[model samples]
Target: MRWEFGSILPPEVKYNLCEPEILWFNKYSKCLANYMKSIGDNHGLNLTQDSKPPKSLYIEVRCLVDYGKFELDDGESILLKKNSQHLLPRAQCEPLIRQGILQHITQ
Candidate 1:
């Protein structure tokens, strides 16, 4: 998986999920892998990042193929079949846009 240019998921949106980081589908997706790398470089925290925000933070991703309608840990499951396609909405990926888990956005 190589994250390139898509939409980066916000930490807040992902803050409550089980993996609660990056959600990737298909192990070889380059868009996300490269994005993760770039983010890692920016935050210092690899996708596997933890504790506080790094110069670059790392997170996990549910492959798009396996995402969208799955049962989240909140106790619900959704199914989109095997050929459906979806992308995480920009509004939903807002965490990366802000600079806080504690620091808040800098404006």
Candidate 2:
């Protein structure tokens, strides 16, 4: 009932959910375990025999260098800027941290 193309769109809003990071990690770990199980079953590889269980570790990190693009949980890609802090999965940023591109921040 309203066609206001000339009007500017309202600003995007964000809210704090207060969800604990550990809960999200647990859920994601389960998903990874399930996926590995399916893949092992399909290939008859017995992946669990030589591999440890999947883990999800969330860590606070600060980018030391500008990373080109990184995907968020929402599947959108964003640029990681130098000195910007972010809460991300350890698996995604561990290598970068080890390479001095990111630094783990203790809170």
Candidate 3:
């Protein structure tokens, strides 16, 4: 509900729910948010994004900003500079693309 309706429910909808239901909804929303945060780790992985499996293992991307170094799962670090292009792992760069720091180049 928090993802869809936001933290606070609309006034019209709130009037329809009883006191207990409203309270439960608030508590559930908080718990859900906390759980997501706990699992997100340093990169702040958003579970909602990229729900589908990638068709390819690699993708071409252009850095939108000077994001500095980005390390892969295998400990290989790559320098990311503004307008620099790279063919990187799809899974590893998905978050960066979502953040607008990298633009996926489709051919």
Residue 84 in candidate 1, Cα distance off native in Å: 1.1
1 against 2, candidate with superior TM-score: 2
Assess every candidate by TM-score.
0.19, 0.44, 0.58
Instruction: State residue 103's C-alpha deviation in candidate 1, in Å.
Output: 32
Best by TM-score: 3
Off by over 4 Å in 2: 1-56, 72-74
Per-residue lDDT for 1-107 in model 1, tens only? Answer: 12332244445644554542344433334454566667633643235334344342222222323334544333655453434433333222234224221112222
lDDT of candidates 1 onward, in order: 0.37, 0.61, 0.84
- Residues 17-95, candidate 3, lDDT per residue (tens digit)? 9999999999987887677677834545445455576789899999999999999987999999999999998878887
The lowest-lDDT stretch of 10 consecutive residues in candidate 1 is 98-107
Ranking by TM-score: 3, 2, 1
Between candidates 1 and 3, the one scoring higher on lDDT is 3
Q: Pick the winner on TM-score between candidates 1 and 3.
A: 3
Give lDDT tens digits, candidate 2, residues 65-99: 98878886559776789989888876567668879
Q: What is the lDDT of residue 78 in candidate 1?
A: 46
Model 3 TM: 0.58
Residue 92, candidate 3: Cα error in Å is 3.4
